[model samples]
Target: MACGEIITEPLMVAAIDLGTTFSSYAFATRGEFKDDPTKISSYAWCTGSQPGLSLKTPTCILFDKVQNFFAFGAEAEDKYTELAQGGGPHTLVLL
Candidate 1:
């Protein structure tokens, strides 16, 4: 680091998977060049769930064409379940 250099705060960021019918995130951050006893930069920068854990989170969002908003995650799943239980005219479509 340069003398009197302003060290910016570290942060985590990610982009979601928009086309796979699910949400996803990708990210990056500065890497350490020297080994230090304490203070290591965050290894995983962007991911849906948590990076480096073999897990990823999807960024899929579902909407009601008529309602014009969104019913996300388990909420969307529950809506499907409700339609099933009542044997309504609901159908599943991927966007």
Candidate 2:
């Protein structure tokens, strides 16, 4: 495939936007796009800082004391906040 050429394959396309403060992902299948070019599917993140639904989630990662994966996105923020309030040791990585 050439850089300037359009892809003619019938497949699903996904994209991730990893921003400094927030992150989001969107996807669409070829058939879906054909039906509605402006239609795309994305997840709604429920963050602690913000009420209701949000398009993007906080770009944060939480790990256990042993460096194991704990949570991501809004869950990560909530967990980290809990740990901090309870004076628990945890590793938080902000992306």
Candidate 3:
């Protein structure tokens, strides 16, 4: 250790839960969590269908033949449905 030295680090921590049907993400800062464990916050994702926000999103993604990303979650669902109706080629990842 040097007499005059400094160390820098992130002040926040986060996690993601990718489930078979849905996924969610949460985060908390070192100070916020230390002050109160309940300070940890989880976000609600927006959806294209239905009203109001949801605690999680459908675990799905849309891509082209070359694997270029198209959309995720509700948006992906909508886009995939549209493309399917048009008989277009695409890939869907659901896990």
Candidate 4:
């Protein structure tokens, strides 16, 4: 249709999955179904990999309170120290 064209013919009902380490989402519509992957990734863009509300949101959420985090899955702690100190790559990247 063109810019001023009207939309006709539509469907209903939809089933959506959110992905691993996360929940799934589903609802109803008035057109086609969206059973594909629309992963949201970061704090930008509403389409193409927004993964913000998914498990692929990258472990970028930094904390700034604790220090010395060298264990597995202990990144939240590690980032805290790096951000709190405001140090350069020498402190966070090298270590």
Q: What TM-score would each prediction reach against the true structure?
A: 0.35, 0.78, 0.71, 0.18
Residue ranges of candidate 3 with Cα displaced over 4 Å:
1-10, 87-95
Off by over 4 Å in 1: 1-12, 19-21, 26-60, 65-67, 89-95
In model 1, the number of clashes is 10
Residue lDDT tens for model 2, 1-95 = 76888876858999999998899999999999999999999998886666789989888888776777888888888877777788865566433
Candidate-wise lDDT, in order:
0.46, 0.83, 0.78, 0.37
lDDT of 1: 0.46
Candidate 1 lDDT over residue span 3-64, tens digit each: 99876754433445454544434554433322332433332223322333322333344566
| Tens digits of per-residue lDDT for model 3, 1-95 | 46766546457889999998888899998889779978878878887666789989888887766777878887788777776788876466422
Q: Highest lDDT: which candidate? A: 2
Model 4 scores a C-alpha lDDT of 0.37
lDDT-based ranking, best first? 2, 3, 1, 4
Q: Which wins on lDDT, candidate 2 or candidate 4?
A: 2
Q: State residue 63's C-alpha deviation in candidate 1, in Å.
A: 2.5
Clashes of 3: 0
Q: Residue 71's C-alpha lDDT in candidate 1?
A: 57
Instruction: Report model 4's TM-score to 2 decimal places.
Output: 0.18
lDDT of 2: 0.83
